[model samples]
Every structure is written in C-alpha cells, then in structure tokens.
Target: MTDMIDLSVATRRMDRVLDGIGDEHLLAATPCTEATVGMLVDHVLGLTLAFTAAASKDFEGLTDTPPTLPTGELPGGWNDVATARLSALADAWRDPDAWAGTTRAGGIDLPGEIAGLVALDELVVHGWDLAVATRQPYACEPDEIAACLAFAGTVSDEQRTEGALFGPAVSVPGDAPALHRLLGLTGRDPSWAPPG
Candidate 1:
C-alpha cells in the first residue's frame, strides 16, 4: 500500500486562494484563459464533489460523459462553499478504506489509491490556477509538488498530444523550482499574471 500523503499541501493552498478572492474578481480571467475566477471555482467544486463520491466508492452520479463545466450558483458564498467541500474532500480520502479497492472518478474506473493521488494533483494544479489568476501568493510543500510531478510524468506523450488528459508539457528552465517545473509540465506558465 502506498503511504498516506498529507493532503494539506492541496487543501491549505486552495484555502489561501479562495480567501484571496473578492467578489469583484469573480469574472476576472484566470490562468485557464477560457475560464474566469468563478468558472474555475465552479470546476473545483464539481471535482471536489466527484472525488468525494469516489472516496466513498459511490457511483450514483458517476458518468461516462465528460464533466460539464459547473454553472451552479455560488449562493452559499464561494469561500464558504469551496472551503467546506474541500475540507470534506480531504476527510474523505483520509480513511484507509477510501484508498482500498476500485473506485470511479467521473466515468473512469481506477484504484482508490490512484484516485486519491489524482485528487491531490487536481487540487495542486487547479489551486495554482486560481492563485496565479488572482495574483496571490501560492505556497505548497515541495513534497507535494514532487508527488504531482511524478504522477504527471506517467502521462504519455500520445495522451498529451491527443489532449486526452492534458496539453503538451511546457518547457521550464532546469533551475526552476519544483512548483514552477510542475506548472510547466501541465502546460502552464509559472510566471503568468492577470492583466492590471
């Protein structure tokens, strides 16, 4: 069995990003050019819910269809909603049983342990997306970046070329820090910033 990973790397960073956002920034563009702050938060919420179900081995809402961009109202308040859901996500995966046997994330079926790591990768990468888009400082433990980078390396060139999982990995300087390197691997520029 793989050792339990500290999910705080993802959760703490995400919480910081959420806290840094203001209502006026909701429609502002993020690192994901096609997505704005609100759009990105919506996406995070959907994934949080999907992964929460995966941890429990529940598949009631799981589907072969790709996830539609979340368009739900953020009525409960963005910080309150995202914060609560993200916490639940961490708690769900904390259970050893959540890392045992097979589970489904969206439509894909994979091992529970693998799913948990994937969840972490999503949190880290998307958390960065939120932070950089909003011009906030993002700090994650080096071990967290290393873990995501290792998993990202497992994605084949073909999968990236086909855009099946990600865009082609962007190049980064050899001397880049782990987070910068990890961002580049996901086709994101680490120095990206919103227009003033």
Candidate 2:
C-alpha cells in the first residue's frame, strides 16, 4: 500500500484511541515510563506536527523538536492536540504535491514517501504506546501491524543497536504473527499487563 494510505489509516486509528481515552486518566503515568497519558498523547501529536512540517518544508512555527518520549505535558488536552494534528495532516495531505515534496529539518533530508511511512510507523507504535501507557487494549488490524513490521524492517540493525531508535526488545511468542513478532522486536510486550 502507499504511504498516504498507511498514514490515513493510522491517523484514523489514532483518533479512535484518543477518543476512547477517559478525561480523568489523561494525565496518569504508566509503569513503563514516567510519561503521563497526556504527555504520551502530545508526543504523538508532536510527531505529526514535526512530520507535517518536514513534508511541507515549513519549520517556522514548530515550538520544539520531536523527542522520542514525552518531555512535558501536552499544551491543551489530548482532544485539542488531536484536533490540531488531524487538521494539520488533513491540510498537508490535500496538497499531495507539497506533501510529496522534499524538505529538511535539523539537517535531515527526506522525501515524501519516507516522511509518510515514518509517520505511519509512529502512528502505529505510538498508538500502542498510548494504549500501553493508559492500560487500554489496542486493537490494531493485522494489516496495520504488518505495515509497521515492514517499516520496522527498514530500520537497519545498526540503527536498532545504536539504542533508542525502537525501545528495548521484547520476546515474541513463537506462535505469534508477524506483527506481534515485530512489536516484540521493538520492545512492546504483545501481552503487556494493564496498569494496576
């Protein structure tokens, strides 16, 4: 499938996960990291903005660099962040030529397909992150998982070993599917325990 489709589907799934979150728990943290639910949500939104900025070749208004983890709280609630991110993505996607255009950020140069696919990976992994961080079940379709797996494969083993590109690796069940295996390879427990 094209990166655009992956990006669209991933964003929809992200919206579903964000919509399902309870307001009270939005700021709660998980055992895996100190990132509160709100922070995780914002981290995902931050990622969207960063990618959109790169795709559109606009780096003027971004407040900060997209960190691998949440450095602080989300400016508004998850709803606000979600809305902004969705709007930005919708706007960027509208100008396919622009989105498909090239640009640079922090000295890194990338094409549209690379940006979109990277965004897709983030959407999927961070969807898992939000779910895992919030003690919710992430019902990712098998195909989405497959897409993530394929993308993850592109990250050279050298990159994985460099540390933090994908979190610590977890063990996948021998009988699990490719997506589950891939998730395990990237540090998420497929059968992660819910928060107490």
Candidate 3:
C-alpha cells in the first residue's frame, strides 16, 4: 500500500486559483490544448465529482464515463460549487479504506491507490494550467509535487497513447526542479505561456 496523501493543500491551492479567474480569461487558451479556461474549469468540476465518487468506491454515472471536452460555459455560482466539490474530494480520500479497494474513474477500473494518485495529479497539473492561463501565481508543496512526479514517471508511452491521459512526454533536464520534471513527464513545458 502506498502512503496516504493529504489532498487539502492541493485543493486549497486550486481554490485560490479559481478565485482569481475573471470573466475576461474565460476564452483564453490553457496549457491543456483541448480546453479553454472556461472549459478547463468545467472539466475540473466534473473530475472533482467523478474522483470523489471513486474515493468512495461508488461506481456510478460519473465514474463510468470518460470525460470529453467541456463546453465553455460555467454554471451559475460555479465557483462555490467547484469549491465545495473540491473539498469533498479531499475529504473522501482521507479515509484509509478509500485507498484499499478497486475503483473506477474515467471508465477505467484501477486500484484505489492509483486512483488517488491520479486525482492528486489532476489537482496539481490542472491547478497550474488554470493559474498560468489566468496570470495567477501557483505554488504546490514539495511532498505533493513529489508524489505527483512519482505517478507521472510511471506512465509509459503506450499507456499515454492508449489512455489519452497525457501528451507525448516532453524532455526536461535531469537537474530541473521536481515540478518541472513532473510537468515534462506529463507532456507540458514548464515555460508554456498563453499566446500573445
């Protein structure tokens, strides 16, 4: 069994990023090529709900379907809704049992431990995506970044292609910071910025 990771820090960081996003940034491009800023927020909301269900071993609608590109519209009071869901997601995974069984997320059945890591990775990476797209500062703790790095490092070319979990891994220097390496492994350039 893997060490249980506390998701509060990542969730709180994402909440801060969400707070900084304004209406003007909605149509802006994000690091995720398939999503605009608004779409990415929608995706986050969906994934937050889906992965929370996964933590509870609830294999229902959200867990059964793979996520598609989101429409670029946010629900009324989406920030409050998203924050609540993110909090629930963190709280769900704090239970040791949540990491002890098989769970389904994005229509793929995998071990609970792996699913937790995936959830963490989503929060960390997408948090960065939203931050950069909105011109906000982003910071994640070293331990959280390390955990995500370990998970991202394990993804192979075949898994990446088949699962569509990431783009082709970008090459970063061996001596780069852990976050940069994790970003590279997840197919993002550390220096990526919105188009001028």
Candidate topping TM-score: 3
Candidate 2 stretches greater than 4 Å from native: 1-3, 31-34, 61-69, 98-101, 105-107, 161-163
Cα TM-score per model:
0.91, 0.78, 0.97
For residues 95-142, what per-residue lDDT tens digits would candidate 1 score against the true structure?
898888988886988888888888898899888888888788778887
- TM-score of model 1 (CA atoms): 0.91
lDDT of 2 by residue, 38-93 (tens): 77776777777776777677867552343565664656565767866866775675
lDDT of 3 by residue, 36-145 (tens): 99999998999999999999999868899988878978999999998999999999999999898799999999999999999999999999989998888888899999
- Candidates sorted on TM-score, descending: 3, 1, 2
Best by lDDT: 3
- Candidate 3's TM-score: 0.97
lDDT per model, in order?
A: 0.80, 0.66, 0.90
Kindly report which residue pairs in candidate 1 clash with one another: none
Distance (Å) between predicted and true CA of 5, model 3? 0.5
**Global CA lDDT computed for model 1:** 0.80
lDDT of 2 at 64: 34
**Over the full model, what C-alpha lDDT does candidate 2 score relative to the true structure?**
0.66
Candidate 3 stretches with Cα past 4 Å from truth are none
